[model samples]
Target chain A: MSQIDLQKILNQIEEIQALFVFVQRVIPYLEEIIRFVQETTPLMEEVSQSILESSKKMPTAVAELDKVSSTTESAASDMLDGIERMLDTINNSISLIDQINEFEKERLMKEKALVLKLAETLDGIEETQAANVKQALDDFYEEYLAKNCLQKLRQNIFCLQNDAYEIMNSLQIQDITTQQIMAANDLIESVQSKLVALTNRLSFLFSASFNVDSSQVKIPASMSFNTMHSIQDINNDAPGKTVETHDSEVSTNEHPNVDKIIKPAENSTCPVIVTKEKQRTNDVNIEQDHFLQE
Target chain B: MQKTILIVDDSATIRKLVRLVIESMGHHTIEASDGLEALSILTHTRLDMLITNLNMPNLDGFQLIQQVRKKYHKQNLPILILSSEEEPEIVERGFNAGANVYLYKPLIPWQLRQEMNKIFTQAKLGRD
Candidate 1:
């Protein structure tokens, strides 16, 4: 062949070899397309079955969810009811606390009122007692020991005795003031009886004139020794010693003769009795005597 | 500047009640459960006056007063003792122990207010 012809033949052989290589690459792509179709068929069937099963289960699941939601809603409503009751209880408790506060306020007010009342009562008692004490002191000075003293004393003493006996008869000893007054009255009565008896005997023996214009005659100042001694004997019959003093001796401070009247005055509230030891013995004797009688 | 008071008591209820009354008068309050606690707080905080109960757990009213006087070395620290025991000797002892005023418990709020006002005014005058 010529050189140009030989070159053309070589170029054609090169083109044919390139065509064979392209054909060999196209065979593998065709086989890959066939393999892809084979692998995708089962996978597509599995996906379709799974979707069908999921779709079928959705309604049942929705029904169960609906039931659960309704139950939860009912539970929430019950909780709301319980909360409402709790609120009511709290309200009642608050009201009760208010009532208690009101009661305490009222009680405090009453206590304040009571304290004021007690103060007023004490003031009244003090005022009344002050007036009574003043009146008693005035009466004691003006009525009993005035210048008409001895005769008045004799009359008042008798009256005091009667009044004392009456008070003792009327009152229980538990009454403190009444018991004290009654005891004083008893002492006045006993002393007054003895004095009255003595004065009458002195009047009889004196046999002297009096300056009184009235029929009730006053005894003469000059009474004899025998008559006064006899009067003393009569008085001494009671539980005390006899005093045989002249009127001169009675006036002297050395004699302290006024104690005849003053001794009873000092012991006016207390009865004259034996010593405490003698009294105890007397009490036991009385008890034994009573038992023997029984 | 507001005046501050220290109230020392074992009872929370009493402390709260006192706080309400004192704070209502535009004053500040610091609370301590007992005298020892009050002594502890006083070390760090400034207080114008003190109101304490007589009977307390850690330290009693007399002991607290003595301790405070000793620590401060000053006579101007006002103490008001409040208690139910009203014996004259107890009141005398409180005054002897450097208490400014002694008062009975379940106190009238108005009376307490007056006393606190008086003591605080005195304290102010002293500081001035």
Candidate 2:
């Protein structure tokens, strides 16, 4: 235990104190990181819970949409059937009325001829009375049957049948609505896949720290998109595309294959931002260009 | 004059509605559910008019019209578009594809008949 030994002991003591200070400085940062983890854990779990909840609900909603399409189509078919039956019945009625009018009209004309021939043998007031009776018979065919049955009633029925057809035209909305639903289904499916991918990435990143399981929630892959076009990405690709600028309204154009197209309208409600003006390039002729879409 | 017409659309309701109009006018109507179905019918049946919708499954209206235009019967058979596709470029493309007239959906029943009659009259006049 000389002075050199004392110096060695002091150096060792200083090194220990420096190491303690370094650890002391690092402790707050470590505590902050631990606190951040503690705060974010619930938030992450909440996000996972929210995603799980949405994934569960969307499929039920999609099933309801399918029911709506099927039910509407069935109803439309029934309605068309009723309309067709009505038209057939009306046409048959018109034919029957025409046949009856012709027969009754000919019979009335021959009876009037007989009455007039018999009146030639009648004297004074009876002849005029027979003439009046003949006039009444004439009125029955011309005024009563022709005016009421042939002219107005048939015409009205024809107009009514046209009105029924107009009702059928309104059924076009079923197809259009189906298209809109298909478009929505297409979007929802896309969102589902993206969310699933995001969750997978997130789970992989936090596997060591988080209790989140990658398999906890899953969104089913979409079975099919709309049948409006083929599988060409140029032809049938769904959005992330938006409308090119036009007047004040958002563009809802369904054709997505233009060369200069940046995006298509996401929906009626979502306002589109056009970074570049879209040009309807006439170059991508459907005959010449073809490609497969994912 | 009555003429035989082909109504091509994926929607059965649409085809039926158009058929009702044609039949009501004393004309005969044949239907095809898609473009390919239409092509199959066109191979054997002689049509005076072709009423079509633009978007469809297998071969679309544009493709259908193009194929029809290439045939000899296209000279007599006029093509009419009954579609909800209102985009200008798309409509222009339809006309360029050889559609004689383009009609939008939610169509007035009488108006559609009037348009069809007008087309028939024009085609008859053209032949004369």
Candidate 3:
């Protein structure tokens, strides 16, 4: 062996020592992580089981809340509907009162016109004839005209007063509707706010209880002999053959093709490795046995 | 057919280690004490791979790789850089210089073998 080979052997031995130390350090850490997982799994499972039960409770609570919200919504909607109907009724009554007031004003105008015509008739008579005419007119008023005129005008005033009362009542209805609408708005807002709060609480609870299993922390081994052994197997079957075959025949090219297959042969201690005779005899034995069997 | 590999480093120990690894693999290794010596050998002889150390007295591994990459543009030579330095910047520099594998020492034989095997296989596939 060359001095270089001796030096490499020394280096390999050092590397192996370092690798052993590294592995020694790492194995405990891995065991600790594994042990921790093993110890913590039951605790985690218990926590998860409790969370699952709590999650079950959440759905029932959510369902109750949903029912309450739906009922409240329906009740509020019905109240609004009733209020809307009341408003429509008030609006219709107000319109009717306005029509009655318009009819009363027309009646009043007609009565005033009749009163003016009577005054004009009285002006057409002379003053000297007034004593005789006044007596006759007084008799006519007492007997026929006075009763009719006073009764008709009183009836018109009564109708007008009744229309004004109706208008006042309609105004009161409108005020009550406005108040009811305001109250309904407040109720709806409060209910919606409560529902939103419940939803937010549910979201928080859901997130908190969602169990996350800490997966096994995998750390690479310091030096895996198994991995090395597999690599050696591959090298033995393919690359090793290439190296042995190529190295036997030297190339004349500026860049020899053999450079690609070169590696430090690790199995040098096996004295039987380089010999062709041992392999040939083994092959011959197999062949001779096969022939004998045939 | 002895696969010829060039080892470039100022450290006698590292060169010796690499030479041993190469020989143990039943391949031939040529030594260069520095980047300049590596460059001279590279010019005269064809190599399968170059295993080098980054820090050297004259013409460090980086300069050597640069020179080789420029000269052997057609050779498709695989280079392995062995160094004790663990700085990210230094590793990037080695990669930038066209090193196929960067090994931090103390070198593991198995790891070294694996890397060498990969380079050889890849180089062979490229030829095929």
Candidate 4:
């Protein structure tokens, strides 16, 4: 009985000694793992803090994205409206060209009639001049006997020549005015061509700007603080402020929701500012009362 | 002693009108279509006065006046500007270009005579 127990006790002791050796072998690996965990804890905490900060900013980012989307939609809508207006203006210009053509035709007709009338008047003057020459020749024989009559005839001839000269001088207005009108027409045509080129370029730029798909537009998650502030500044700026016009109806129609979007924030801020001003006044009054009491 | 005047203008009608008015005063007039043509005529002929209209092709009245001034003094050969343009700046430019007088067009014959008489009186005084 004693030998059996001793043998069993010795085997258990050997097993215990093997277990201690195994534990000793694993201790450095355990220490390395613990050190690794300790080193990674700060990184995990930083990750958790970063995730918490992102979560805190998510609403603001989403709101900013919504605002950007709205702004883009509004800008695209305005651009499309501008394009429509431009097309209408082009149509009006086309109609104006027809009007100009009609006006030119009428001007030409009037000018032609005036020319015909002028030619008739000139022919009549010529006939009258020829008759006067014939009369003068016939009267010369009768009048040449008298020196006084000859003098009167010479004076009459001079008067007739002066009248003809004056008539010739009065006709220069047409040519000068015609040249001025032609120059003005050339200037208008040049301006029109330049305007058309400008309109085409504007149309191209607007089309490119508006063609960006809103659904595909993505705001970067890791946007810098300065960039975020710039985005906020852009959001705070008055929408449709770039458009200026004499027509109030057009402006109002262009940005129907602008007042709706801005009025609530304005109203809320106005009350807050007024309340703060009142509180400041109350604080000043309280300080004055305390000083008077002292 | 009839004075010979050189008339430069783009318009034939205006030239004729000016010629008639000037010739009525016993002055002989030689016509040219533009400043360049007037320069050609002036190189060959001795002229008492030069009457030019502004805004002509090839050479303008200012260039003509400057060129004429280079050859003749204002007292020797008086340059008169006859133009339809009534702008003050244009009148000032004409005077600056060495014109003795700037007269707006649709000119009265008496006014032309008066101005010419004044220029002639001045020229005569200068000669004396």
Candidate 5:
């Protein structure tokens, strides 16, 4: 080959050498990138599997939440029902007190009339005895002494009338007891209403949290939205009304809707975590309802 | 006619008070500390009327009334529930369980007498 051709060959050899060096330098980086991809492939698969497992548990978690919410609402409703029953009992007791008070008042009035008549009769006796004693004073001193005894007897009769008055006044015990019981009943009813409101709010919160409907939750019939709304309306209309009046309104019956209140466990939309013992107890309650209906 | 009344209560004071009131009404009162004792007495004695308290040991008034209803007709043998429990449900239960009348505790003397008289009158009418 000529010298010029030798030079061109030398240049080509140098270019090839540079290219080879570049490839050699890039090869390690490519291998590192390949290694990194290989390592992350399993990690991506593991992440995808974890996401799939979580997605599978979503419905189960929601179900559990719904169950918990239902249980809590049911328990609260039951407690509210129990408190309402107690309030009804208190109101009945108050009614008894009123009846007793009426009876006692009538008896006292009758006794008072009788005692007044007795006083009138005693006055007549005293007047007659005095006139007779005055007429017989000169003829019979013993009769005068007997007149003194009669006067003392008249005073005793007056004292007896006063004792009767005192006895009549003592009937205030029933009044006071009645008032105390009414106050207690009012307090209990207030607590019940507050509990009802709280239960409603809690049910609403739970329903919202679980993305469910509040109306679907099984609450006491007396603590239903309509009942609460009515109570609120009453309160709003008559803010000055006593708690006793409010209590009277609510405690007039054991449950506003007796049939609705009977089967709360069965009416729940969510799963109830009832034990075997609780199930048996519920069965008994159902049997009692049947018996009552029968 | 002096009727025999069985007064069942847990409190001795209440029993005694009831007995006194019943006796004053010219009725004979048999006392029992609880429903069980009352039941035992009932098994042996002939009672004209039964007055029971709702809250009692051994057996509650509800249970007693239920048991008594199994044997006695409401009209034939009168059962009066005299209890501190004034729940409408309980009252309803008492009446359902063959009770003639339900009277609440701390009862007025005359009111109780009136109720007793009413039951006795009913029983007499039924017998006639």
Candidate 6:
């Protein structure tokens, strides 16, 4: 409107030139950011997928092992019952055989007198059949069928009772195995809870930093995974209850109770995320390199 | 005299097996699955001895022994540790907790019988 403002017009042109140069400088950073996201997305997803799969599979594994322990325990109990019955039956049989042997001994005394007199008369016979009959009679009389045969039967029955007891003793292995299974189940359960916690933390951090769809990696509410669960909870308490783990008693007492381990006030940017920018850090420590802050 | 002994172990099979051996010795036995249950039994039952395992949930053998020794004399309610635990430090801890004797698993029946007899005999002799 007034005289031509040549200096102002020239300044405006210079500003436009500077804006173009700044945009040109920013293009490489933008491309790098795109490339970084393109490369890192799959790796982060893979890690998340691994944690998710492990958390899901851990409980099933623990359940199968628990079934094995309980089934074997029941089987062992049944075996012990069978052995006890065998011992009791064999012991009764031994007592009965002892009584029969005593009765045979008395009868054998009378048969011996007759056998000796019969042998004296049998000595006069020369026929082969008669000699065979005489030989059988001597064997029967001398062998004392009631005492020798019946007493031998009793001894064998007693041996069987001892064998039954031996089997009963060997079944103690089940107890050792049960303890071992419980320890293993506890360790697995512990790892599962820790995995779930870690997965949740990582999913939150990744979604906040890189806009990753956390829902894919984060376990749903249905999983309801809790820490410190154990398979030894015959007490029928809650899954995360203190009554489950054997060593939990000591550990729970040692740790102070907390309402929540860590919770954010709201969804916010993680300070340590660098967003694919070049930077240098003097702090070698990972946490304080408070390193990703660029 | 017939002494009443409390058998404390998490394993039901072990409890039953130990019960049989104790009963065969002509003494009575009471059973509990853990130290907490054993402590409850000790509150109301008059027991002459306690036979416990080292490893268990809720409360372990050493803790139970310490609690028992606090309430009863070391010799009054004689504590015996029967366990598969082979660690010398754990065994020593059991003895330090007021255990009167310790026995290992897979011990022959006659050996257990003899040990039980020795416990009773020693108790009798101590009382006399």
Of the candidates shown, which would achieve the greatest DockQ relative to the real structure? 2
**C-alpha lDDT of residue A129 in model 1:** 54
Clashing pairs in 1: none
Q: What order do you get sorting by lDDT, best first?
A: 6, 2, 4, 3, 5, 1
Put down candidate 1 lDDT per residue, A166-279, tens digits, no spaces. 332222111223223444555555555555555555444333322222122111111122223222222223332223336434221211111121111121211111111333
Looking at model 2 chain B, report the run of 10 residues with the lowest lDDT sum: B69-78
Query: If both were scored by DockQ, which would come out higher, candidate 1 or candidate 2?
Result: 2
Native-referenced Cα lDDT, model 1: 0.54
lDDT of 2 by residue, A1-294 (tens): 999998997687557545544543444455456556667866876786678678667777788887888788778878888998988998898887788767877877787788766765573656476677667767765765545555567678779867776677778788788778877887887787777777666666566555433222111111011211221222233443323222333333333332222111222111112212134221111121111110
TM-score of chain A of each: 0.32, 0.53, 0.37, 0.37, 0.36, 0.50
Candidate 5 per-residue lDDT over residues A25-119, each given as its tens digit: 44445545544544664575455455555545555555555555445444444443454354445445556656665675566556555555555
True contacts kept of each: 0.00, 0.58, 0.00, 0.19, 0.00, 0.31
Q: Write the per-residue lDDT of candidate 6 for residues A48-162, one digit (tens) a residue.
A: 8899998899999999999998898888878877876776678678878877877777777667666656766776665454566667876876765644677677778878877
Better of 2 and 4 by DockQ: 2
So what's the TM-score on candidate 4? 0.42
Q: What TM-score did chain B of candidate 6 earn? A: 0.93
Report the TM-score of the second chain of model 3 against its true counterpart. 0.94
Q: Is candidate 3 or candidate 4 better by lDDT?
A: 4
**Which stretches of candidate 6 lie above 4 Å from their native place?**
A1-37, A105-147, A212-294, B1-3
* Candidate 1 vs 4: which has more lDDT: 4
What TM-score would you report for chain A in candidate 5? Answer: 0.36
- Candidate 4 local lDDT, B1-128, one digit each (tens): 79999999876666766776786687999999899999988888989999999889999999999988876444468899988889899999999988989988776667888999999998898889
Tens-digit lDDT string for candidate 2 (B1-128): 67889999987778888888788889999999999999999998878889999999999999999889876347557898999889999999999988888998855667778988898778678879
